[model samples]
Target: MSVTEYRQASAFGKRREPHTVIIARGDDIRHFTIRPWLAAFVGSVLAAMAIGYLLATSYLVLRDDLLGATAARQARMQQAYEDRISMLRAQVDRITSRQILDQQLVESKVSELLARQSQLTQRHGRIGPILDRVKGEAGGLPESAPLPASKPELRAANQPVIYADSSAASFWSKRPAPSGPETAADRADRLFVAINQSLRAIESEQMDGIGTLTENAFKTADEIASALEAAGLPVDIDTDDEAVGGPLLPIDAGMIFEARVRELDEALEKLETLKAIAKEMPIHNPAPGKPVTSSFGVRRDPIIKRPAMHAGIDFRAPTGTEIKSAGAGKVIKAGWNGGYGRMVEIDHGNGLTTRYAHMSRIRVSQGDTVDTGDVVGEAGSTGRSTGPHLHYEVRRNGTAIDPLRFLKAGKAIGKLL
Candidate 1:
């Protein structure tokens, strides 16, 4: 049995009373006393303890949920970080691939340009000998002024970039990694610019060489024409003074190079034509390495001692020495002529003729085509010749001029030979 006791105090009295609680279980009883202030204090402590236990229980019951939420948030953050890294890697790969493609394209163009430069070099080699020949012929001519020193040297663009794998190397080395796409792209762009500049330089050099060749060809043609005119022969000079007419078209680097090549070809053709004309002209020495015994113009006649006009120059050669044709022509007369025994007359075209007088034997008949070095007869003291001397005459329309003029022209032509 259990019984509880409560004691009340009077309002005016100072006496304190206690409340007692009894509890019995299986014939056992327990009593507890509680004062007003003590009860209040104990009740407050118990209520505080109960509140704390409730709060702790609530936190324990919800701990898993809270922890799961925090873990989920952390997982999401890690996923976001991984995705960003993946995106960065993809961006880097794309940029690298694009850069490689651009580099390959530039290399291809450089290869083509290098091939063209090689072709130009070969053409220059072929023309070198011809230029040397022209220079030799024009030894007395004034030298051309040197080109400007400021001319840029031709650059071969085929050289590869030094830092081809710089971007890849930056990833591993201590050097700062690439900041962004702009850095890689800028490097490729710089390479392209360098190649383009090199191509332009080569093109400029080719243009200069073409110009020089054209000038040399023109000079040579003019010199040949001048020499022909000075020989008192009417030269039918062909001039290309007409203006060319065509529609204006856009020109590229390859087109410019082709145009230069065409110009060089035309110049070479004109030079060749002039060379042929000069070859056919009577400008070769009849008796090479032989001393001149008598000169043309007013001189005392060898047979008749009188101050008279000598229409031909005489060459002193040994008896029976080979006499070659001065120029390529057809022998018109090979038999005896008045005052010129054993005379050989070659009728060259353009109203020019060469006469070789005083020969021992006539080896060529009339209507025979004789080259410049072909043996026509043997030298001898025949007809007006005094003693084993040759009388050579260059006549234009049958009017004799100085044969020395034609022989002097031979000096210029000999250089080409």
Candidate 2:
């Protein structure tokens, strides 16, 4: 039906009729009548009341369960959040501890490197001048020239140019400490990386310096060896022959750097020892500006008037002429012998000795330490001589070799000195 017809029918029906309900139970009967709209309204009210009662009852019965479930879910969420927080805290603690340890290691390395560099600087200060003197004596390159550039220098020179980054110390020092929790971890990470890079650069420089120093040490050692060989004395070189055996322990960069420094120190010590030994040996002119009167070996003895092996050379000098020691040594004999009157015998180390015979006066006593060029006595014809002359002999293990060899060697070495 159309909407207007339906509405008209509903209006007529509401105006015309009232409905009645009757109930009969056993001996009683009841009847009631009402308008249709009022009955419908009363039925609706009854249905609404019944539904409200049911909803109220259900809410009373199930309210505790619903609230308990909600509380349990909230507690689980809280526990989960707590567990997550604990895990994150643990991770943060571990990361913080690791970073602290790394920082400590880097600081220690930096301290060690600083100490090593200081030592190297001191050594360079002390040894550089001595090396220059040695090179001057050896006729090596001029002192102003760069000391024979090494492989490290060559490599550095050949390397391509690189942009420099900010210095770690400055960068870290300038940065303010993070105030917020969110950025603290990131800041720590950056700090560790920067520190690591700085340490690497410092270690690299140290290694390169060690390489150059080692090369120079070897070169110096070679020169010393050659000098000692020319003197016919065996060189005592350090041969690090001790065996190292273990479970193959691992070594870090710092240990290697320290070992190189130690090696350089040993080499320098050896060089010093060699220099001291060379100074004490007999290697200087004994009687300067004196004419040779007699040569060594077989000659006619002036007193005996027969051919005899002359063990010493004779230098003609006027009476009271100064007789100097050839090298620094302890005097062993200074009194008169049967043929050698007022003689002086010097005990140079290593079984080498030099004797000056026929002196007019002995200036040094036995057991007195005399240095090279120190006046030991006066030249005179005191014993077994036809004229005032100094008889000089070089003895090795109580047997006399030609003294001319040592004189010639001294003359050659004196030019260098």
Candidate 3:
């Protein structure tokens, strides 16, 4: 046990010897012997183990760095994805807000349009009667449907319907034409513009029609007034009497139709006044289809053999021919008169009077109201040397004027009546 022994061995054609290792500590020595082959084997084993350990250490260190880098990269990727999502969300929110604002604006526009529709409807009602009354005289306006001509609802369950042009001052034009592709809102807006333009055109037409009617009415009234003026009668119509006293209610600036309506009303009132006066005068023929046999003038008296003033015209007919009043009036005198058989007299106010002489039978009594064409008497030959005929006189204040003048004037304005 104290001596080391080694057996000889052959390796790679060389004789191998045992290797020795000695250790000394504090003068106590120890020695160990190893065979050469064994030593080489052990050295090889140790080198392999060192190499394996170094490789394992390097792999662990590299793996930690790789894991840390990978984690950082993943975190960066997650943060970037979230940032993209946030940006998209913000854009969506902005778009939603804008859409909401647009919806509200559209709703406001719809409300304003509804109000205008109501206004236009009221206007139609106001002028309906006036339009009817002037149909015959002033070429009638075209009949149209009531205003606000569309449905009131501007939205459906899923989408909004943006139509109905409003009366707001700003809505006078069709604005902000749609671009890109046509949407429901765009289509509805187009419809609104078309409707608005069409309705406004109708309103414009109405205004024009009323203006024309007023002009024609004024013209007719002027004609009547001129005719009456030539007959020693003056028409007195106060058309522009500004005796208005009321609260200062301001109207919308867009209400130009009101002025037009007022003008038409004044014109109509004036025409009505003149027409009433014209009707009251001796305008209609007392005897329809009756021809005048004798004209009123200084002529040879058939029975007196001298030239005398013939103050009335004579209409020869059968003795029992019906006679009528020349105008609307109150009967002043009726029945027998000196040399004029059964006579009838009418006082058409304003100092105008008419007489029907040589009547066999008088139908109207004193104080009886008689309209134009009313049967007042029957024609007869009881006047001074007159055959079966009617003697008609138009006198003013008891003096005879040319009955032809009144007749001509009546014929001139007959169509207007």
Candidate 4:
């Protein structure tokens, strides 16, 4: 083939190239080389590398952002959990504080109760023996007789010798053991149980003491009555019958003693309740104002010319003098009576009754309950009285008794009249 025909075939097979290439500004030289395949391969490799780099960078940034967000969310959740935990801890602390305060208060109250119980026990400790002697005398028992002057040795030895150590020995023997180490809640429970047990023990002991005292009192009363009967005095013993105008009989010693014991028990129960309420109250005398204006016994009648049996003791006072109840009881009658003007009759259970006569004003009505030292009336001269005075009578089953004996016994018992 000719060169022209060859050139034409090559031109049709080759790709287009740049027209010129400048080497210098003034005098330029131009050269051209045909390498289309190599250029295209290089371009494709560079483009693919750029695209891969960009995609890898984007993926890395997105992964970092996602990890940071996940970490933040986890941190927030942890903080929330910690906050809840803290709140719960605070609540627990508050509850614990309150529980501690309550426990302290209870302990204080219990201590006060214990102290009051101790005081009461001490105050009433000596009353039992005195009452026993009296009861023995009242029963007319052969063994329970007063010693004659000839038997000085027996009388001297028979007298009771009071000692201070007796109560200590009893208390040490009866008190409960201290609680052992345990959780606070368990300890508190044990403490309360022990307190209750102690209270019950004290109550039981007090009741027993009261019963003994009552028995003794009855015996002494019986002995006194028997002595009076033996002395040629006209005395009678009655029970379960209302008293009339006639010479009333002496009370049944046993019944009167039992009644007194019951009354003491009831009074003790009330006192315990009061002590519980007044744990921190100040101590004071129960009877604030009291004075004995008269004594109990037979005397010449001021108005009557004939010898008469005196049923009660009279206390002279100015008109409108305040009259207080000597003990806890229920009012059975409050009004003007046949010979007792503005009288108030109180029934202390167990066949014991008290009458306040010649009162100017009655503060209590029938069926009204009154406590010891309660204002029941105003003293005045009424109903067959010579002057302004209070006629106080204590009766057992409607039988009159000597007021001096009871007053003296109450004083010996450490009672506040």
Q: Highest lDDT: give the candidate number.
A: 3
* Candidate 3 wrongly placed segments (more than 4 Å): 1-51, 135-179, 239-255
Each model's lDDT: 0.72, 0.71, 0.75, 0.60
Cα RMSDs, all models:
9.8, 12.3, 6.8, 24.2
User: Please, what is the TM-score per model?
Assistant: 0.66, 0.48, 0.76, 0.34
TM-score winner between 1 and 4, please give it: 1
* Candidate 3 minimal-lDDT segment of 10 residues: 145-154
Cα lDDT of model 1 by residue, 359-405, tens digit: 88889999999887788998888786668877889898899989888
lDDT of 3 at 218: 74
Model with the higher TM-score, candidate 2 or 4: 2
Off by over 4 Å in 1: 1-201, 242-255
Ranking by TM-score: 3, 1, 2, 4
Clashes of 2: 0
Off by over 4 Å in 2: 1-218, 222-256, 288-295, 299-307, 316-319, 408-417
3 or 4, greater by TM-score: 3
Of candidate 2, the 10-residue stretch with the lowest lDDT total is 148-157
Q: What TM-score would candidate 3 get against the native?
A: 0.76
Number of clashing residue pairs in every model? 0, 0, 1, 15
What's the lDDT of the predicted structure labeled candidate 2? 0.71
Candidate 3 per-residue lDDT, tens place, 1-417, comes to 112222223324555445788999989999899877787898999999999999999999899899999999999999999999999999999989978987886787677667766766777777777766565444312233112212222233344323223553346344555567898666666556555554455555566666776777777778878887876665888756598788977776356677777777777777778777888888667777889988889988888779999998888778888998888999999988987777999999888899999888898799999988899998888858448889899999999987888888888777666
